[model samples]
Target chain A: MTFPMGLAGPISGLVCGVLFGYVLQRGGLGNGCRLTAQLRLQDWTVFNVMFTAILVSAGGLYVLELAGVMHAADIFIPTTFLWATLLGGVLIGVGMAIGGYCPGTSVVGAAAGRIDGIVFFAGLIIGVVAFAGIYTPITPLLGAAAGPQAQTLGDLLGLPAWAVLAILTGVAAGVWWFTRRSAASPAITCAD
Target chain B: MMKQRPIWNSHAAGAVLGLVLLLTFVLTGHGLGASGAPTAIAAAAANVVAPAATQANDYLGWMVEGGRNPLNSWITWEVIGVALGALAAAWWSGHLRVRLEGPPRANNSGRLALALAGGILSGFGARVSAGCTSGLGLSGSATLATAGFVFLIGFFGAGVLTGLLTRRMWK
Candidate 1:
């Protein structure tokens, strides 16, 4: 039997967004402090959740594709633009630290009744407007880094997808183990 | 009399999120996103306010092509669902409160201004990168996309550096 059995696209997106949003809100990840804490090396919760989610989904998707249960090519893989991605990411990250919310968490934070989230969202709108105004000038840099290549980790590393997945999963497991052990200490626990 | 947890356990919450992502892929041949919703809305607004200018801009033009309503996109509706879901979660956990959050030293006005500035930066960045954390970093990385991984690194690295530099903002 097919999984996700006959659900329409919009309905599926709705259900998925709801579930994803709920998890983010409930996990205290909707808070900017908790997320930033990961960077401070104080709290491992964010790292734990993020890596785990990535590993699980990555592994799951691979397995499903291998089993012929899912068509991997149908997935919406974003194109690569080395310069644009790096520049945009750095800016977004800095904004997250300053504002205490990324685009996604900011949305959730606003929903959770944080006034700051609303303000942050307003800034996001303005930022988009500014970008649009200057789009002509930046278009070349933004869209011209490299080939809009659809390469994967395996392709870059010259390894099989499964191999890369296994390595990533191992790394995640190691981080989890270390973080858990460190968290058990009274001092470290307080830091978190 | 009782201390309430912030929300749910991270692992449990993450597992649910993973399952949802998996389900999304299975059904829609795609994944969840957040920032694109607003971009589309903003594009539509530009189209209405300044159709000529919107048409002149390559990015906005792409969004307005086919005479499709930007608000009619999947990302827009899903973002609505996100707000609703977060509200539900917050309400259930009794964490729904209205207040400005900032470092004790910063005034509400300043905090609000900074928040707005940060949001603007993030929104622009999302547009430049073609996705935010969820769409690019999470979804893209999950699929092992090279651009996604690069974005992830840049995003997190810049975040840490900025967070440390602006530690006073949240203190």
Candidate 2:
């Protein structure tokens, strides 16, 4: 209810994190090959899982916001820094391809006793420290273009949030449909 | 020594994860995150070791000002939970194993080195962009934040390109 802090926060977070991690491992995302299969265009499982989650949560949040049950404004919607988003995304993407796991997956993999995951996590700590050490020089660029405005996909596209969500969901569904059909065809081996 | 069943159906798992994200927002008014917790921890540690230097640093200073134990963070707990849950699932599924993942051609040392480099880059990127894949890509996108969309585009776009470049790794 009220934001988690102190004992309650850590307990709740631990429970949630465990569930989240369990789901990730169960989804085969803990496996590097299954995740990188997306890059090979040989598997659509990653895309399917990602967009499906997006669609469900997007729709769910919209409904919650509309019902006034959840104050969407309370959530920390990050400000848009065009350059940071683009640069950060590219860096993370490259890392995922090379490392075979993103931050979350790396954690899950580590729990499953994957040596690579542990190493990656150690790197993550080092990276954070490195960023801190260089914060003065990079502060401007890192925080650049971060206006306090709460813009969304709808605002950027000049459409209603629900409408955009609907359109996006439809597109995602179409992709899923096509991927399913292709995967089912005898010729394709559908990697994991 | 035995074949493993395919992990839960992707669609089903995605739906569950989506609902979890939605619940997180509904209950706490925040999305799931993984990187910030560690950063905060690092900041707190820095503060203890070198209070003046930590205070002087722009990033660590912001974290220290937030007024709470660095470890007492929502993301921190969620991450801990993630590890527990993952272990449980692995145990149940009989897929739990201690091993390094890499192309059969790669050695353990090489794989470990790459993992470290990748982690560093990913962590820095998450901080710069303000969130990691889950926090920014999933949570942010669900919220329809503009930054989220930009991040999604940048991450996936670069992913495809990089994947192409490293085609041999997977093959």
Candidate 3:
């Protein structure tokens, strides 16, 4: 069910974007060292931030849905694209390792005045165009595999999405606790 | 310019970001996104030059999902906001300055070269994967999507492996 949003929609979006960006910068996520540290598993800052955000969003959305105030947007639902998800995921991972900035945080990095972020942004645009140019040629391999399976964990398990969400919530909380606890300790894990 | 202030605690930062996402969903009916703008720019460029090819390629054709103007999407506007927001945060925190992020031993040219390479790979990857850490990891997983979980697994696994292989770049 779509909520009744007029100017509230875009206004809230901008406000939320500002809030999110502010937090990311303050968290040092826009810094490449922090980004690479997470990859090395030497710093759980990225993990802590990401999982916690997921938990909050998931929990909030669940409540809103129950109240009939919110529903999933059609555009945000990632189509099945089994092969693309798998292959694309691997590539994104490698790129994150190499760049230390994903599409979102790269914006933060650029704002923080990192030359790397700007270069990466330019490359990202070029890459998008490159993909578009070659997309037709790989249709059989990439496009044909696209299907709208909905790709939710709930669908795969024959369970309600809320159940999987509950499990995920638990996992996020557990991880958040573990990271905090370990960060407090000097010798628990190589990563703090 | 003032010296950089220390950053916020990770947990606090993360939780606030979550609330922001929740607000976004409630208001706009969509979570935040980062890659749509670049993709749209690609489409706009194609339309300007090779209008025919824009429709020819199945993948390229998606630039106009729902027959809406790709360049004028809400997400695109939000990304512009992202830049401004980041700039505000950085300026306030004294983090806004031109600097290259890399290992100490690297020269400017080398740092730039690496950044470009990494950017190209990441840019291509985001397009191929259809989302990045935010779109797939945060937003998708929040909704209990399998693809997001799969993406997280793949993203982290590859990140670790690649980081190990290229440790010298940042160390």
Candidate 4:
């Protein structure tokens, strides 16, 4: 079932993107205050939403693969780069803490008519340009730091895909339970 | 005045989002993304300014390979859909307010400045990590990729530390 990238690709992309953005907006991810509150540990909405999403998707992917609808190996698996990922993660985390919006969330923010969201999006483009300008020099560094090109956690852990997913789901469930109990406390504030 | 609608439950929204993500994979053979569109746009702009240099570069070159229109990409159209979808959501929920967002203690200009700086950092970071929250975090993690988990820990850990340092901005 090779989905040709002629006319149907962009249409499907648009439809999926719409659903993706709509769900994220309904989840309150477009709000900067809510995002910042998550980082401060004063709100658990981000965690709750993201953890549940990860669990559901991870489970669904494995199940669908089992049903022979798709092969998990056929999906795109980004290569691991320990150093670059760490550095990039730190920068992104700092940005999220200060700006309160990731690239995806920024679009939602701008659409919601927030001035900061628009500004943040402008800055994102600038950053992209900056990175591209230095790509020639940075490629070697990134290439060298790229780690094992494993397919999935199942490959790395010597377990089946379903087994890895089940273990991860259990861990996520445990964390979710803890987060709910914590949310019940007076730790959160009226940020929004 | 329009009555404002509260957001949906986090769990429910997450479930729906997960399904949407799975649908994207089944339909498109890849997961959703946000940063790729901007990157493509940047490549296109660069091509306009310096076609030779753009074609020679390692990153932007691939986007404009063989004089192709970078904007003629699925990711670009998908992002356009994101904007419209968000617009509809905002309109329906009465959240379409034209104002700067942050804590009351932070002024509008200050918030905008921080937002810009943060965006720059995230933009650069996303390129370095090869994806944003959707492409890498959600999609990668969904496929059980190890890089996704590593990136998640890095961002979350760093985010918590930075948040603690910037408490006054929100407080």
Best by DockQ: 4
Rank the models by TM-score, top first. Answer: 4, 1, 2, 3
Question: In TM-score terms, which candidate is top?
Answer: 4
C-alpha lDDT (0 to 100) for residue A28 of candidate 3: 78
Query: Relative to the true structure, how large is the alpha-carbon lDDT of every model?
Result: 0.78, 0.78, 0.74, 0.81
* TM-score of candidate 1 against the unseen true structure: 0.91
Cα lDDT for residue A108, candidate 3? 85
Q: Is the docking of candidate 2 incorrect, acceptable, medium or high quality?
A: medium
Q: What CA RMSD would you report for each candidate?
A: 2.9, 3.1, 3.7, 2.2
Which has the greatest lDDT? Answer: 4
lDDT string, candidate 4, B71-155, tens digits: 9888888888888898888888777778788656778788878999999999999898888888888888888888888888888
**How well is each residue in A1-192 modelled by candidate 4, as lDDT tens digits?**
443122336788789878888888888888887788778777777877887787787787777777776775567777788877777777888888988799999998898888898888888888999998888788876666676784567777889877887797788778777777555446554322
Report the error of model 1 at residue B137, Å: 0.4
Candidate 4: Cα lDDT at B126: 89
Error of 4 at A51 (Å): 1.6
Candidate 1 Cα errors over 4 Å, as ranges: A1-9, A181-192, B1-5
Residue range A79-109, candidate 1, lDDT tens digits: 7888888888988887887777888888888
Per-residue lDDT tens digits for candidate 3, residues A61-118, read: 7787788766655325566577777777787777777776888888889888898888
For model 2, how does the per-residue alpha-carbon lDDT over A1-192 read when each residue is reduced to its tens digit? 433222336766776677678778887777776666676566677787778888898898777678765665677676688888878888888888888778888888888878998888877777788888887898779767774587888888899988999888898988887778643334323222
For residue A32, model 1's alpha carbon misses the true position, in angstroms, by 1.9
